[model samples]
Target: MSLANKPNRKLIATLAALLFAGSAAAFNLDSNVPITVNADNARLDDGKGIATYTGDVVMTQGETELTADRVVLYRDETGLQRIEASGQPAHYRQAATEGQGKTDAKALNITYSAPESLLTFEKEAVIEQNGNLFRGDIIHYDSVQRVVTAEGAANDNNGSGRVEMVIQPRSRQNTQDPDGSSQGQ
Candidate 1:
């Protein structure tokens, strides 16, 4: 939809929820914030309950944001069903709950299915949160169950064919000793 004039609030709200819900520590109020989308071009087919935005597309709700070269949104009678975004590397970011900092992700393609509460990243997928990192050819996050699965490239001789993760150690300053003083202190 040319949302330049009449924006679809329902669609936007549904999208905001689906996008941010994947983050386990997403800011609680993000879903209640108004969403804004900007793109060079947009096409909406109400009959199919589909909308497509091309060029540099940026969507934001509160501290959560997504940017890509193209984005497609699909909805059914119930609500938004799925979202697909593609770019050289589509990017997503959202504030984490309280002091956890932010979660950031990037991939060549990203897809989210509302009913399944699943978020998938494909092609050079990478996600970083709280200084921890996960990288693979594909990654899936189950928001409801708070589980993550990743797959590396196939046994192609040219590729490493292994998923990679870097889990940073918790800072000593945040850990308390048995005596109730900070570990570092």
Candidate 2:
């Protein structure tokens, strides 16, 4: 069946929401935009309520985009249940709110679960937002609770197994002084 069919409209909408819901304050209008997917192949199984897309699958909604080697959608009678994407390194990017830069994430695998409202990034997961960066073996974001947790490699005997984070210092801008001159000059 065609993914653009009426029956699959809800599925596309749910997928858009799942992909962009990484941040609680994500661009509000992103979900309203139509989701577009381009892939070398797509297969839908109505019996199993699953859809799979492979070979350089790229999905986009508004300014948010996700690219992967393979993408799978799982649905139930209730609606969309989960989405999984795998690649050499699946990538996700979304335009952040005004003033903040974009948010970019990449991992060997990315998964979203609707029931838990969670997003998981595994295997060399890295997330960068507004000049701040986080890297770990596994990263989990709870959309509903707006919490993020990460874990380092489990089998690493070296100290390099620890997660890493980098936060950039804010730049100071010129401010008016009491005497009407620039204070930061």
Candidate 3:
């Protein structure tokens, strides 16, 4: 859980062999950094500690970046409390360690709560990491606890939305033996 520690190489190499239940948040190292947002237009209510941004909003927090049509920031005396972003399909991306590829996410709406360290994506949410993809009607990610939950949307009809995932096969690599002898050697 500590970002300072290096990711398990064996785990990364064998990720494809692992059957993901589609209930884990993307691994990001910059979750504790400060967030910065930008937009063409903004309306700030200092008294309420609320700010609204429209027209191609973009937000960044360390290596993580988010883009949307509109974004609203809620803050208190202690600083940022929550962020709400909405668009036809908002975008989210973050770096994935040193050698791993980046993680990407898309959704119609994304809400982040600073107090709870939770991120909720609604309406056709999808996340792709390390060539694998996870899809669902709703995805809730708890950054602090590193827990994730994917939920299906419910309509008047039965089984409107279902969670889906696509896991790619791991590429073969030269691995060393337990005795530290190089396989190629």
What TM-score does model 2 achieve against the real structure? 0.73
The lDDT-based order of candidates, best leading, equals: 1, 2, 3
lDDT of 1: 0.72
TM-score of each: 0.75, 0.73, 0.71
Better of 2 and 3 by TM-score: 2
Question: Candidate 2 residues 87-157, lDDT tens each?
Answer: 99999776644335466899999987878878899999998764467788998876666566667897566
lDDT of 1 by residue, 1-185 (tens): 67662544454334333333335532222256666779999999999999999999998778778899999989898867788999999997776543455678999999888778788989999887655677889988766665677778996886698877765455732353433233443
Clashing pairs in 1: none
Q: Order the numbered candidates by TM-score, best leading.
A: 1, 2, 3
What's model 2's lDDT at 76?
Answer: 95
Candidate 2, residue 102: CA error in Å? 1.0
Off by over 4 Å in 1: 1-30, 172-185
Scanning candidate 1 in windows of ten residues, the lowest lDDT window is 12-21
- Return whichever of 1 and 3 wins on TM-score: 1
Output the TM-score of candidate 3.
0.71
Best by lDDT: 1
